[model samples]
Target chain A: MTRLAVAGVGAISPAGVGVSTLAEATTLGRCVAAGPISETNVAVLKKIRRSAAITLYAATAVEEALRDCGVSGFADCALISGVTNGALNFSADFHHTLVTEAKETASPTLFSESVLNAPAGNASIIFNIRGPVYSIIGGQSIAIKALMLAATLIETRRAQRAIVVCAEERNELSSFCYSRFNPKAARVFSEGAGALLIEPVDERRPINPVELCTITGYAAYTIPGSPHLALQRAIDGALSMADLEAADIGVAVSDYKTATLFREIPTLSFSDCLGYAFCVSTMWNIILAAMACGGGCPVNPLFAAGLKKYAKHSEINHVIIYAAEEDGDASAIILSRVGASS
Target chain B: MGIITSHGVGVEANWEKIKAGESSVGEITTFDASPYRGRLGAEIRCDTSAPVSHLRAGRLDRASHLLICAVREALGVAGLIKPGIDVFLSLGTTLGGMLSGEAFHREVIEKGISRARISKTLDYLAHYQAVNLFKEFALTGDYTVFSDACASSANAIGHAFGLIASGRYDVAIAGGYDTMSEFTFAGFNSLMAITPEICRPFDKNRTGLVLGEGVGILILEELDHAMRRNARVYCEITGYGVASDAYHMTSPDPDGKGAANAMAMALKDSGFPDIGYINAHGTATKYNDLMEARAITKVFSSGNNGGVDIPVSSIKPMIGHLLGAAGAVEAILSIMALVEGWLPPNINYVTPDPDCNLNIVTVGREAKIRALLSNSFGFGGSNAALIFGECR
Candidate 1:
């Protein structure tokens, strides 16, 4: 079996910003109705004015991620951040601000923070991570894909461990981009971030130490359904490769944008509570999956996420399943439990 | 590795034409060129008005057009365009459908949200390009869209190779595609990287680089996967190296430390005694030419931990330059050279610069090439090198 483990996780999500708050929110089924936060004067150096969403939430998640991973800083770790827009908060607004009113006093620090890998850069700057730092953006798959890449780096022994960070702001551009597709669901517009600390599942570590059950496989489909058949093929292929039957599978994470698609399966959507934060759904599912490992009591549909069916699958040491939808598209991954005496 | 390029579309056809030293860079036929100064590019000659099936799903931009065409041809050439195979798609592009934004700008100014926002739904936006292409190609496996400027495709191909090498994906389709757009043309022009006339790489009189258009893709499969199906293998992607200049966003360091490190790493990773031919990333820019020459010199002088010096050349001179797709296209040229014993020439290397003192195969030569190294450096100090060798 592939030896993989979740070393740490970071998120700048809607669940109050940090891991502790997010975990509390998830455990208590807390829901916070919020709106887009604007960083109008975000560029000042001594004045890093962030939307309440950014400071209150993202900061908390990042701290918890570092703390969990025993990463005091970026002192000697290879940091790979999945960042979509660099200093976008600064750059995106810079042009508009300059063109509209020419505010030379606007914060350049905010502009600097707009670098694509800001979160990783921030973590690096905060912790002094001095190894290879890379930032990549692939729509919503950023977090899951980053996890896979971190695994590759560890498996190759490129670095002892890789800190994977996925942070997104509730910027107007993101909301505008998403609202273009699902115009009717404008209220679904929410913002947050998520991150993970991945390291090699060392043999020296305790066996069954919260290991990665398995990442069945991933498939990407186009927006208009060119990959319907391809998606099924990937699912069947991964199942076959694992020498398991489709029915034998228990939990799955689907990148579902809407709840109607879960027509007849036990489904849970962290998106309902977190809102549509693009990549946040994928990272949030990590926590959901971890929580479900203890046989999550059927998802309560009290949450307006349209989760009517409790299509729970049979459990055979498999506790978590997840799926995330990106721009009317999705990628699903299934993770099982790593405990012994299964 | 499978071949799919704009020279003639497929491996056999491209190989045949490239052997004759023919130039396909010509007038832009995809769109009107009245507004632009340079209207030349090697566009894929394919009828895109086919069935609206898996291949034409989500990409509604020019870059997507190039990618879909290249991917279809590549999978067909590799005989891996069938069911039961996990198709992993990776593509690289410098400017993705920015032309669409130009259109959106006009629409927003003239028409308004009904038109401007409608255009935003198109996948040409940099962030959505890869997502749309994956959807269009119906590739439902591991994939990534690299945007590391010029080295984007090389970095992408390297990643795909690793996926296959690590026994993750059985078949990986990796390459790059870019279209001639006003945004990139103006941007590069603003940077003063574009030459007024034909780009003369490694020459004293060379002014700057010329931006070109095209898409090139390769199909990488596991050695056992290839042999088990009796499929023909062009070459094994032996060495892949990546580094960053960490210097300037646009200029390469004068000494070429980053470029040299990339070359040394590629050779070392391939574990080859000597690189038969190197498909140089000859952009012809002042700093790039000198830095690449310095890099080649350092690699040759060091002897690769005890190996011999190698021959190198750049096809960018003949085809202009494919920007984000240059590395993927040149890599195809390198792989083809190893397969057919043909080295593409650096057509416009008349006045050689003393700084660039390497065997550039100025007029294009032929030899039994067993291994080939392809170099690609991009803006933002990103550099990547790939080595392809015959499957042992």
Candidate 2:
């Protein structure tokens, strides 16, 4: 088994650019409203806006993440981007153009960006990452899938390090479809990007115990017609891999309501503060879990109350991240502090 | 392995057509392509009137149709469709259901957004295809969708290979599928990457690539797992490697560094001193062929077999470029050649360019190959190489 470490992190949520900003906002229990992205801090690529907002957001987050890590060269890094809508803006634009204008007159740039892999490709170009690049498409569970792939890549030695980025952009078509599918759950939809740099854990180097998190195990399952069952199965699979029980988990982060499964475990949710960001939701939760383990709190007030109760019993060591999409796809990941493994 | 291509459906049908050196590229009849500069493409002939009994009626796109047909054939061959067996599915595609999405968009525009069925909009999602497979087959296993431009399926296979080889999954269904759509066609045409004539890869007079669509499915099982099940292993996937040029979005590096690195990585992973054949990512474009040729020369110029010439051929001419599915399709053909003792010729190779100075196989030749390598480089400089060999 290969032990992996989270080297650096970055985020481009509604709150702002850096992970610190997101953590600060989350600690205050502030919910940032979705709006147009600010370009002031981002290093815009040429004609990047012509692509999808997902791609732009991913590029921004990746740049910030790399900068935060103080790693310059990416020749050996692999990029695994988890996406839900992919290029929703481009898809909508292309469709709008095709519907209103002739097929021949549709913008090729929009069509190019409309493909599911456009954001990964654009990020690869921006970062000069030559190692294997893959775009894993799914619902909210995609972020966990990306983490699993990153761990696999590192474990297999296919890549020295992997940059896993999950991003989703709000658009009319997706918003409309979500509203039509589930009205009550529609208001939580938001748009953002989160990036994490993961690599094989090196014991030789001096590492911060707080910043250090090991991806013990991950699991994904598809259960038709019952997302709750799928989530349970994934959690079970992950727990088996980590050789831990639900009671041993210090913090459980998820977009879905996990009170039924992880009853006594302290649960935290970023969607409460960040809203539901599709693919970005689970990743945001993961960043917060890492911060919390590193002695930082980004939980909402209600979740913070639960965290306070758990904090008295034990120091934050193990964090379990779970996410299930409406499509019945579910994924779970277990992250534990380096020296705090049970 | 199971395959559905423009030449026809099934592995044998496509193999026969490719062996005959026949070009499947023709006028685009799926839709009105007269408005585009390159109107020719290789399209699978599916009767829309007859629906697949298992799949949802009226909502299946051409890509999904091809995928379902291919998966059924593959599972039938593998005999792994029975319940209680856990499978990890990794599918690769550039556009999942753009055809259906396009239709939905047209309907929404003509009728109204409110009139547009939510099911139709859901069909537009890339993962919707995987979801359909999960429900249709009752696959209670992990699944992932890979969309890395033209290298999509190749990367999918690579990832799947890793999953199995790492003992993560006992079995996996890895392949790629894509449909030729007006959206993709117009985009390629605008980029001037589509050839008006049949694509002549590596030929001196080659212009550009011709669009094609199909699906290729490979049922991967661990050696011990297959042996225990008495499964007939067609070929062993020894190694796979993926890399990016980091050069440009749509163009390959002039030095072919990324392509060469991928091949090198695969070779190292395979622990094979030399490979007998290379299925080139020969799009027949000006830059791809040149870069791929250079990459090949860099890797195999000084072979361990004492300067032996490795046979190389591009099946893109016969099948056109399948885009996202091209990698898996070409990889299947390469494995077929390794098993059948013949080289798939590069048809339409009238003249050779000096830039591509390798030993290009213009005519089919008989050869007992031990190992073969297949290359696929896609838009955004994504490059992948897969190695397959006779099962030891």
Candidate 3:
């Protein structure tokens, strides 16, 4: 098991303002969702209205992540994020207000956030991480990919610790996007973010050690034939990472988007509790797996799949999370739970 | 990477025809440029006859088609593919598929622009023309679409290089693509960046730029990966340097200090004091050409040409300005020059500016070129320079 640790977290989601608010809401199964409202012209009002979009969710999550890490500065750390649609969620009302509200002498710092990498930029500014900041937008598999990247950062020893954040904000416009494609399903549009503070576990440091969940294995593939093939590959790859088999295990977290649910077999239990979350579903699954480990829930491996419409069933000694996009790109990461007493 | 020239779609076909020095610029076919000042532009030949398989797959957005054609050719030439290869697809594009959105908007406007029409248009905000390209490839890798105006793709390539060099990803596909959109065409027309006739870079009587569109992709891998896999190496990306002017959005720094700084940084990063050839970002604008020439002179001048006397050329006369895609395309051209040992001519260098005195490769010439540098400076004072040399 890799000795990677989640050192800190920050978040902004529909459930409320910060990570604490989101965690409290999640405990009650409260989703930050509202009926679609008519588009508004008030920029601030629009931000208030559609602020559930992943971009804003990501922004809030980023701020919280920095704060939770006690990172008052990004002066030395590299900033990297998994952004699915970037600032595309920011409405024209926001831009218009930004353009109109700027007096002749606009503050230089105001529009700096307008950059697509603003989430990382803001985090960098807040934390004073003067190193490198990177932002990449993969479809729904962005979160898993981010975790993979964070691991790579640790493996390379670029920094002792790095911040890896995955967030999606609610956008009123996204409804049209979903309606055009998956019209039958109730819009599972929820704006939320999940941020993890990742660091190397150092036995030398005299600090309260966070319980570690090791990332065992991961794989990503884009197939034109069977979208399900992606999930199968991830399952096989993740299991082999630990040199384990399908029956060795415990619980699972599946980050499969619901849009692809109709295309799969009806065995997974997600239909009962976790409906569909495009990207956040991955984090949701991880949260569930963590909960299962905490409450001694029966070990049922989470099987997540996307548009590739494939199912991945893993039997592991520890919890595992599966994440995939609809169009055939899928990734599976095995997490080894530590500290059974906890 | 992929090459989308008017003569043909793939590399072999383009190489066969480019030797003739044929001007691919002609009348605009995608849209009516009749009322426009610069009616001439480059267009890619689409092979619709080949059936595109896969559900919701074959429908290629204008930008996507260009990307597919180009990437396929590049991959074929590279002669290798691997699973578990993390990809960073970086592209610089603007107003992608907005032409389609405009078509949708026009129908609504004809019926009278209503609240419904307004919402529909705003929704297009999320559907940038480039996303269609990503969907077409089914690329599940981490990616980013940069919209830094003109110098967008250059920044994309530069950033991709940084990511790879910094050990973020072992392999990456970085490039740029832009199709002429009515929105961009009209906007540039309004801004007076479009020249009436052929663009004359660095010429005394040079006018503005002519707009063109195509896709360019560079399949970049870590140096070790290419060697181990025995992938055909076109050129090694030696140095990439980026700087912001914070000077102006539309205009470049007139003093050329920012441009000079970027080139110096690139050369310094490459650790190469000697530069062989340059693919100048000579857009032929009155100020751009003069400014770029001054910048080049300051960096390359050993005493006369500054300090380093090197041959320089701009292929914009052949392809016109591809805007967001220019950096990637120019970088491709630079790599090709290193590999092919031939310098493409500047084409329309009938007269030269007294202020710009470097050896412009006006005529296609053969040379033992190894290391080359290319420049792409975009709006908002964003400047990027990339140096590629024969893979050592």
Over 4 Å off in model 1, which ranges?
A14-18, A21-68, A71-139, A169-177, A184-187, A203-268, A287-321, A324-330, A333-342, B1-59, B117-120, B125-142, B204-206, B245-265, B302-309, B350-357
Task: Report the C-alpha lDDT of model 3 over B131-202, residue by residue, as the tens digit.
Answer: 444455555455555655556677678777877887667777888877766555555664567788887777
Would you give me the overall lDDT of model 1?
A: 0.60
**Candidate 1 global TM-score:** 0.76
User: Candidate 2: which stretches are off by over 4 Å?
Assistant: A44-50, A102-106, A203-210, A297-304, A309-314, B48-55, B303-308
Candidate 2 per-residue lDDT over residues A1-342, each given as its tens digit? 777877778788888877877887777878787645564244655647567788888887887777766667888899999998877777767777755777677776787777787788888987889888889888889999999998888889888899999988887766887888888775667777899888877731353323647788789988776788988999999988988887878778887865698877877776767877888988988887776665544443434566776665456678899998766889999888767766
Q: B217, model 1: CA deviation in Å?
A: 1.6
Docking class of 3: incorrect
Candidates in order, TM-scores: namely 0.76, 0.96, 0.68
Assess chain B of each prediction and give its TM-score. 0.90, 0.96, 0.91
Pick by lDDT: 1 or 2, better one: 2
TM accuracy, model 2: 0.96
Error of 2 at B39 (Å): 1.0
| Model 3: residue B108 alpha-carbon error in angstroms | 6.5
**CA lDDT, candidate 1, residue A75:** 37
